[model samples]
Target chain A: MQGTQQPTPQPTAYPATDRTVPTRSADRASYDKEIVHAILDEACVCHLGFVRDGAPVVLPTLFGRVGERLYVHGSTGSRPLRMTGQADPGLPVCLTVTHVDALILARSGFHHSMNYRSVVVHGTAYDVTDPQEKFLALDALVDQVVAGRSKDSRPANKKELAATAVIRLDLDAVSAKIRTGGVNDEPEDLDLPHWAGVVPLRKGYETPVADPLLAPGTELPDYLRAL
Target chain B: MQGTQQPTPQPTAYPATDRTVPTRSADRASYDKEIVHAILDEACVCHLGFVRDGAPVVLPTLFGRVGERLYVHGSTGSRPLRMTGQADPGLPVCLTVTHVDALILARSGFHHSMNYRSVVVHGTAYDVTDPQEKFLALDALVDQVVAGRSKDSRPANKKELAATAVIRLDLDAVSAKIRTGGVNDEPEDLDLPHWAGVVPLRKGYETPVADPLLAPGTELPDYLRAL
Candidate 1:
C-alpha cells in the first residue's frame, strides 16, 4: 500500500491518531478507523468533487484507499487535473464513497430512507509529481480495486505512467456517516395498513470468465476464488 | 415519476430506439430516455453539485423522478436552495447517479476497472414556486421512493410542505453511460497467471420487520411482500 501516511498537525484538544475526528453531529459521525476503512473498502465507485470554471463538478471515478491517503487517477489533460495543477493554493475537493446496504420501507412515506454507510472527505488535492510516489500510488489504486492485484499484474511502464496523472488528497477533515437497520416509523403508523421493514442489498462476484483468447490451462488465482 | 422527464431540447441525432447500443466506448455517451430512467430509478442516492461562495459543493442527497423532471427536496435553509433562489440567473448544477454492477479484475493492473451505469444531467435548476405544482411535486417525490406509496400513506401538512423546498431539474441535457459484463483483458496478458473476470452485484430486500411499537393486528401490504 502506497500514499498511506499519518496526518500532520494533530490537534492538541483532539490529538487524533488517524483519520478520526468527531463531528458536531456526533450521533451520525464515526472516528474509528475500522469503521471508516470498512465503508471505503466496500464501495466500488467514488464521487469526486472539485471546482471547475467556478462551478462544482462531481464525477464518478474509480478510487482505492491506501491506509490514510486516497488516490484518484485521471487523464493528464482532464479539466480537474489541469485545474489542480494550475491553482496556486491547490484545489479544494470533497471525495465521497457510499454503499447502499438496504432500502428501508416504512409505514409512512415520509419515513422512507435507505440504510447506507458513507464517507465524506474534505481537503485539498495536489498532483503527485514524484515519479517513484506516482508509480506506487497508481499501484495502490489498482490494488484498491481488487485486493492483492497490483503484485500479480504487470506494473505500468514509464510512458504509461507519464500519460496518467495521479492526484493525492490527504485524509484530513474526513467524516463517515452510516444509517442501518429498519425504518424509524412513527408510533401511530405502526398500526397502519402497510408493510414495514428493510430490503437488503448486496454485491456478489460471479464465476470467472477467462478471456476468449486466454491460453488453455491457465489456472484461476486464489484472490478470485476468495471473492 | 415526477422528475424523470427528458428535457425538451432534443439532441438532433438520437441513437436508434433499439437495444443494440455497443457495450464499449460508443454507448458511453447516450441520450436515450430508457437508459436514463433505468439508471436513475435503480439508484437511491444522487450526488448534488452546486456553487457556494464561489466554491463548489457536492453533497449526496435523496432524489426521486417524475415523468420528465427530477425532484430533489431539502431544508429550506440549505445552501443549494438559497443559492438557486438568490442567484440572478439561477445556479448551474449537475446531478449524477451511478450503479456499480461489477468490479472488473484484469490480468494487468492498468486494465482493471469497474462495470457501472451512470447518468449525468447538466442544467440550471429553478425553484418550484407554484403551490399546486409543489404539492404534486412532493407527491411525486414520495412515489418515486416507493411506487403507490403516496396513496397509501398520509400527505404532508401545509406547514411541513412549506418548510421543505423542492428544486426541479429537467432531464434535457441528460446522458447515461453503462459498462457491464466481463473484463477486457489485454491480449498480451492472455497467458498471465491471474484470474480475470467480473463479480456481479445485486440489491435485494429482506422480510419486513414491523415497527417495535406496532399495534396488534397490523397487516402487511402486498406491495412490500412482492418486493
Candidate 2:
C-alpha cells in the first residue's frame, strides 16, 4: 500500500549527487548499476537501519536482490516486518553493504586509510503478501548467498513459508562510493621515517568440511567446488 | 543540551531487543567494554545510520574509538554532521561494525552460513566542542589502527581540526552478537549428498611500504614493523 505521495522530490539530507566530490580521483566515482550490483552481490552481510517511534534502529541481516528490488527475510514475527504492514505509514529503511579490500598503512598515521567499496540504498519497504512473489523472493535470497545452490536445495514447504516474512524495497535511490589504491600521504611526509603503503587484505574460503553425519559417497557440488 | 526527558521510554515500532534472540551459545553474547572496544578497533569501517527528513539514511565511514566513546570524523560540511546540530530531536544514530570470520559451506545449501562478529550501538550523537577532548579523541582514533603510531605522525593542526567535524557517541546502549562454527542442518538432512563445514576467513596486514618521498636514512618504526 502506498502512502501519501509527494508532489516534488524532497532533497535528502545527504544527497549523493550533491555531496559527492571527486577530489583525488574522478574514476572511482561510479553510479553504474553493474558496479553497484557486483559489489552488493559479493557482500554476505548487510546492515539495515530504520526509525521506529522516532528512535533509530540498526540490525545486521541477510539480504538478496532480484533485478532492481532487494528482498530481506526474517521470522514472520519480526517487529520490522510487522511494522511494514501497519496501516498508518510504510517504514522507511536504509540498507548498506561494504567490502573491505585492504588497509593502507601509510608512512604517517595521519594518512592511514582503507580501500573499500560500499553501497547504500534508501527507500521504504513494504511486506510482500503475494505468495508467488514471496516464494520467488525467498529463492532469490538463498541464491544470493551461494549462486545456483538454491536450485540444488529443497524448496521451503508451505509451513516454512508461512512462518517467514519477506519485505521488498526497490533500488530506486542507490549510490556506491569507493576508495582504493595505496595511502595518499602529504608531499612532505615522503621524507618521514615511517613505513608507508597498503597492506592488502582479502577474504578467502578455506577447504570445506563435510558434515559429521553426511552420508558416504556424496561428493561436493560443482558450484561450491568453484568457490 | 538534554532535550525533553520523557517520563517513560516509548515502545519502538521495531524494538531491537524484542527480535534480538541470543544464540544457544550465550557465552558469545557480550556487553563487556573490552570486548566491544577490541571488535570496534579491529574493524576498519562502520555503518552509521540516522534519520533525515523523516527517513532513514545509512552511510559507511571510517571510525575509531577511545575509552567508552566512539569518534567519527567527516568534512564539516557533511549533512549528517550538520543535522546533529540542527535536528530538533538531535540525531539518533546507530553505529555498527562487523567482521566476517569464515564462510560455512554446508552440505545443504539451506544450512550454509557465515561466521561473524558484529556490534551495534544505538544512541543520540553530539558534536564534540571541547578542543582538548577532541584532540585526545582523535589520537585515540589514530592509535586504534596502529597502537604506537599516533605519536610518530603529525597531529592534525588547528586548521585541519577546524575543517573537520567530529561526533562522539557513548558506548552505553550497546550489544554484540556473534555466530560461529558449522551449519545447523536438520537431522533428516544429515544423509543428504553435500559437504558441510566452515571455511575460515582471515584478515592480515601486508608488509608496509615506505612512502615514495620518504627522507633518506629514515628507518621503519617498530610499530609498523610489528604489523
Candidate 3:
C-alpha cells in the first residue's frame, strides 16, 4: 500500500485496508481505482456473499458499475433484496468478480496456477427505492450486458418494476488482484524437459440467435450486428 | 426434493435443505447430481464464503472436483487455508461456481437477464493430510485446468509439497441453478418491434506459448498442442 506506483506516471493508488490485503503475496494486490473499475466492468456476473443463520451464503447474479457505485438486481422476494429493503442500515455484503485469463502450467505441479483478474468490494448495500434512480439503474444493468440494447428495448412497466429489486453498493472498499505472464518455475526446475507456458482463454461473442417467435421482418438491429 | 426426476433416466438428487433452497424462483433450483457435477467440473474458479467475526468474507480460488469431493489449493500461509488446517472440524464454507453462457436481452428491461449455470455447496472443508491423497489432489487440480497436463508435467518435490495446502469438501449438500433459452417477455410485449435474442459468449483457447527458456528441441507435447 505504500508508494505502489513508480511515481513517474498514473494517479495515486487506492487506500488499502485490513480486509483488502492478502495475508500472503501482498505484491499481487492493487488498490488503484482504475484497475478495480476495469476488472469490474469486464465481468458480467458477480458473487454476492452475506451471512444467514450464522453461516455464509454466496449467490451469483448480474451487476453494473456506474462511477463508484455498483447496482445489483434480484427478485423482490429474494432474501438479500428483502433484507436490504427493510433494514435501516441496509445489509452488509461482499461482492466479488473474477476472470480466469489463462492456465499457468508450471514445470512443477506445486507451482501450477492461473492467470486471473479479480476484484472484491466490501460494503453495505441499500435497496434503491427512488423511482427515477431505480429506472436508471435498471437501464444500466441491461446496457451493462449489451450496449445500446436498453434504448432499443422497452422500459419496465409499473407491474414489472414492482416485481424487481435493485440494490446499490458504493465502491469505497475495493481491491483488485491480477496475475499474468508465463509460468514461474523454480531455478532448478527450468530444465525439467516438460512443456510449460500459458494457454490463454479468450472470451468472444458468437452468432446471435434470434428468437424463434420473432415477427417475420424484424431484422437484427445494428447494435446487435455490431456485437 | 420430492421426486425431482421423471419416470426414467438420470441419477439421484441431493437432499434438499433449508439453506440450499432458493426462497424465490424455486423452479430454477436443481438438486440433480449430474447437473451439479457438470457445472462444477466446467468452471476453473469458485467463490469460497465463510464467516469471520460474524461477518461474511468470500474469496475467489481455484477448485477441482473428483467424484463427490472438491479440492481447493492455497498457500500454506493464506488465512482460509490456515483456518481450515488448524481446526479439528475444519471451516464451515459455502463454495459457488457460475458460468454465463449468453445474454438474454428481453423486450422489457425487467426481463433482461443472462443465461447462466451455477452450483453452490454448503459443507465443512477439511485440511488434506495424507501424502498420497495430497499428491492425487494436486494432480487433479492440474488436470482440471487442462485435461492431460498433469501426467505430462513434473510432480511436486518434497519442499514444494510442504509449502502447499489443500482442503477437501464433500458434495452432499450441493445444488445447481440454471437459466437457459430465450427471454421470457410478457405476452403483450412480444411484438414490441425491438430486437431480442441470445448473444452467446464462448470460451476458446489460444495457441499455447512456450516458455522463453524452454530447452531447445523440446517438442510441444500432444497434450498441450491439442489445447
Error of 1 at A111 (Å): 1.7
In DockQ, how does model 1 score against the reference complex?
Answer: 0.45
User: For residue B119, what is the lDDT in candidate 3?
Assistant: 94
Two-way TM-score contest, 2 vs 3, winner: 3
Task: Report every candidate's CA lDDT.
Answer: 0.73, 0.74, 0.86
Candidate 3 at residue A7, lDDT? 59
Per-residue lDDT of candidate 2, residues B107-218 (tens digit)? 4544556788988888888888789977887777677667876787778777778877788888777877788766787787777665565657656766666555666777
Model 2: per-residue Cα lDDT over A1-227, one tens digit each: 27686578643333346324333334666667888888889976788988878877777778888988999888777667768873636778989888877777665555667788988887889888899998888788778877886776666777778878889988867777789876788777676666566666646665666666667887778877888
lDDT of 2 at A184: 84
**Tens digit of lDDT per residue, candidate 1, span A67-95?**
78888887787666776673457788878
Q: What lDDT score goes with residue B196 in model 1?
A: 70
Ranking by lDDT: 3, 2, 1
Per-candidate DockQ values are 0.45, 0.38, 0.69
State residue B140's C-alpha deviation in candidate 2, in Å: 1.8
lDDT of 1 by residue, B145-214 (tens): 6667778776666766787888888877666777776777657777877667666655565565666655
Per-candidate TM equals 0.85, 0.85, 0.92
lDDT tens per residue, model 3, A1-227: 58766655744566698888878778989998988988988776899999877778899988988888999998898988988874468888999999889988888887788888999898889999999988888888888887777898999889878888999999887788988888899888898888888888877789998887776788999888887
* CA displacement after TM-score superposition, residue A82 of candidate 2 (Å): 2.4
